[model samples]
Target: MIVYATHAGGRYLQLKDSLKEQPEGKRGVYVNLTNRCNCSCTFCLRHMKDMAEESSLWLREEPSVELVKDQLESLPWYYVSEIVFCGFGEPTMRLGDLVELLKYVKDIHPEVKTRLNTNGLSDLEYGRNTAVDFAGGILDTVSISLNASNAERYLALTRAKYGLKSYEAMLTFAEECKKYIANVVLTVVEKVENQEEIDRCKKICEARGLRLRVRTYEDK
Candidate 1:
């Protein structure tokens, strides 16, 4: 799906169906830009869940920027509180397209919030500091995955293609985001890491002057 809404129990639904399920109130809408990722996290839902073809986020092929803009243009703006760039894969994998879409959202609905859920490795992916790409008020928040407390543990869990270096790069991206993004958040899955590791992660974020969120296993 190019655009969709997330429901309880980790369900992904079309906007129309989401409205039917919850007829009132605004909700965050998500865009699926691509299914390609740099990491194959051991706990990634794409590897654990089996989704039906009609509702699947696995794109048969990547959509053109114009096509995604069309979908965004037609969204039920009144019911949307936020626009999130997220999918089964890393949104930054399609960094340029993601940025264009973000700007499109801000242009059309400056009141609505915008966020990006990322692994925060675009620095390594693009061989440069990529957080600056979100400058000029295009993005409101960046939620980066802080999978583990240390480089070795992080690489072990994410199995990122960049290996041990991936952890540091992700952190650096998160820190850099603070300059451009209003909210810079780092996240760790609740059960994926124990209390001890999570505490360590908290300290890591604290030391860097970043925020941390412990997401439930089922959170998309």
Candidate 2:
């Protein structure tokens, strides 16, 4: 699906189905731009879930920026609280398109919030400080996967294409985001790591002045 909403059980559903299932409240609308990622995280749902064809976030091909905008335009404004750039893969894999879409959303609906869910390796992917592209308040929140407390453990879990240094680069990207994005969140999945490890992650965030979010196992 190019644009969708999530339901219970971590189910990906069309906006129409989502509304039909639960018709009343505002919810975050997710945009799936591509199915390309820099990391192959062991615990990611992309590897674990078996989704029905119609609702799968795994895109057959990357949607054009105009196509994504068309989907965004079709959304029921009253029911949308936020617009998130997230899919089966890393949104930053299409950085230029991603930024343009962010701007498009704000230009169309300045009041609605916007966010990005990322692996935080855009710097390594682009070999530059890519977070600056979000300047001028086009983006509000950036939730980066903080898979482990240290570089080795992180590499073990994510199998990032950039190798062991991917962890540090991710953290650096998160820190750089603090300058441009309003809310910078570093996340660690609950069941994927032990309490000791989670605590260690919290410390890492604390020392770095970043917020740590312990996501529920089923959270997406």
Candidate 3:
């Protein structure tokens, strides 16, 4: 499915079915853009989750921008607090489409917040500074995966296509994102790293004037 809602147990509900099962109140709606990524992170959910056929995030085919827009247009806007670009793979892999979709969301529902969950390697993938594309208040928040405090540990975890340079590039992207996006955050999964590692990561984020989020590993 192109659009789905995530629940407490890593459960995913298709947009159409979400109306029935979705809890009353605002929740995040995730948009699945593609199943391609530039990194093979050791702790990626794609390697762990056993998704069902119907509710799977693995898209049979990448949906066009128009298709994604239509899907968004059909969503229950009142129930949505945030529209997130995330899925089994990195959302920025389809950077152009993602920006367009973000624009579409702002055009129709300016009150709704929009965010991107990315590995922050878009610059390396596109061979240019991609953070500028997020200007114009189209995106409200950008959550980047800052998996490790150092380059060596980062390369070991992410196995990014950009080699050892990936970690620095990601930090550069985060620094650039601060200029465009209003809320810039870096994240690391819990349990994977010990207290010292987490503390180091916090320091890294603090040094960059960014917030650090410790995401819990969801096994469901």
Candidate 4:
């Protein structure tokens, strides 16, 4: 599905189904642009979960910008507190489409917040300072996966296509995001790392002037 809401079982329900299930509440509406990613992270839910055909995030084809916009426009905006660019794949894989959609969201519903859940490798992926693209009030937050404390450990966890360079590039992207996005967060998943590692990751984020968020591993 192109658009879905996070459900209790770590399963995602299509927007229409989501509305039917829980019609009222402040929730994030996630946009699935494509099933393409530049990294194969060891703990990513895409590899761990086995979803049925209807709820599967593995898209048969990437949706066009207009198609994604249509899905967003159809949603119950009153119930949505935030619109996130995230799914089975890294949203930055389609950076142009992602930004355009963010613009579209603000154009129609200026009050609804917008965010991106990314691996923080867009600079390496696009060979440019992609943070500049997020300038203006289009994006409110950028949550980047900073899975490890150092480069070697990070490379091992993410197995990013860019190799060892991926770690540094990700950190650099997070740093740059601070200048553009309002809330720049670097995240590490719990259960994947020990206390010492989490502390060390916190130091890394602090040194970079960013916040660290410990995401719970949702194994459902």
Candidate 5:
């Protein structure tokens, strides 16, 4: 099935294709928020694909809460098991809108799982504890990127605008997320050298009462 987002709503484009396209048993939907981001990760698919703008997600601009709600309303209930906030860019860039949309979706389909894949810098970005708002909402899981063990390596990987401090900021966000989100995850990109770093990342997650998720590095 083809999941397309537009001003009117999230719509099924042409459903003649394979349904088992996305892994992770996610027969759900993917929502693209905005193309803006605080970091430009070296491994990011945004640089490798055509989804470099909000417009490419078929949005004239960032969708309003009503617009996104309308899209979610049109979705077939059975085909969706989850609703994911993950475009090529940072979903939290449109933090308020994302939260609003999540509330709207949950009101209609409370059983449908909802998730967010982020760089884990929302605290720094929004200057507040954003996780608290997600506590009892549609959000089920939150995946935060922890690319490297050290600040230098993290800076190198993400090329973040926040400098070396972004690593610490991300860890701090993950720590706070544990108190708010039921499933708070710290993810490290897998590579030869990242094995040891991944171990270190696990330790960090463990200390913060969170889980570690090792992601496969695609050579984009």
Candidate 6:
């Protein structure tokens, strides 16, 4: 089920057969951009295995913008419901490439929804407000990782490069993202933290007209 795409006179193909199995209207394709990230969260599987090239996201190396464009171009048009920028790595690390790919996808399939599954450390990693860059992109949702409530607990969980600063930075980014993105969400892993943690996250998200999501810790 691999589909070939052409870009800059070069013919390239992207993997898609496995993704089509998702129920129609619930077809959410997860694209693994890279096996690189800034945070090495305890819950993250980056170090547990050869994750960059796995069954769910098959790739020897991160796909290029042209490669990603080719993959999206090969879709069955209506088989896909939502296209998520997610995988074993942080999609934002390749921000420019991702945005360009999203723009290309939206131009062709304007009805399909686009999303980013990120660790919310793009600002710290790039030393700029990354959310500001999503203004007109095809991105419909930004699902940020809100692993824990306080800084100490967060550091222990995420082992983020920036230490305690990562938590606050993510919150700030969520706030700024609400300005342009229609659906901005702060997601927390259950049990690692408690109701108090979820409550704090809700307060932060609510203050900025955003939503909070509590996802079951799947990697555990």
Pick by lDDT: which candidate is best?
1
lDDT per residue as tens, model 6, 22-41: 23343566676876788898
- lDDT string, candidate 5, 1-220, tens digits: 1144211232233212224333223265777776678998877766644445433454456666666666667766666777888865688988888888888778888988888999998888878877787877568889998888789989998999889888998998888777767788888877724567788878877877778888876543
Residue pairs that clash (backbone atoms under 3 angstroms), model 2: none
| Model 5 local distance difference test score | 0.73
**215: Cα error in model 4, Å:** 0.3
lDDT for each residue of candidate 2 in 124-198, tens digit (9 for 90 to 100): 989999989999999999999998999999999999998999999999999999999889999999999999999
lDDT tens digits, residue span 1-220, model 3: 7788887677789756776785567788999899899998877777665552444788888999989888888888888999999987899999988998899999999999999999999999999999999999999999999999999999999999899999999999999999999999999998888889999999999998999999997765
Residue lDDT tens for model 1, 39-75: 9988887666655244478899999999999988888
Taking all chains together, the TM-score of candidate 3 against the true structure is 0.95
| Model 4 residue 142 distance off true place after TM-score fit, in angstroms | 0.2
Compute the lDDT of residue 110 as modeled in candidate 6.
Answer: 88
lDDT digits (tens) for residues 9-120 of candidate 4: 6768987788889877779999999878999987876666654244478888899999998888888788899999998788999999899999999999999999999999
Question: After aligning candidate 3 to the native by TM-score, how far in Å is the CA of 8 from where it should be?
Answer: 1.6
Candidate 4: residue 195 Cα off by (Å): 0.8
Each prediction's total of clashing residue pairs, residues at least 3 apart in sequence or on different chains, is 0, 0, 0, 0, 2, 0
Q: How high is the CA lDDT of each candidate model?
A: 0.91, 0.90, 0.89, 0.89, 0.73, 0.74
- By summed lDDT, the worst window of 10 consecutive residues in model 4 runs over 46-55
Query: RMSD, model 4, all Cα superposed?
Result: 1.4
How well does candidate 2 score on lDDT at residue 78? 90
Candidate 2 TM-score over all chains jointly: 0.96
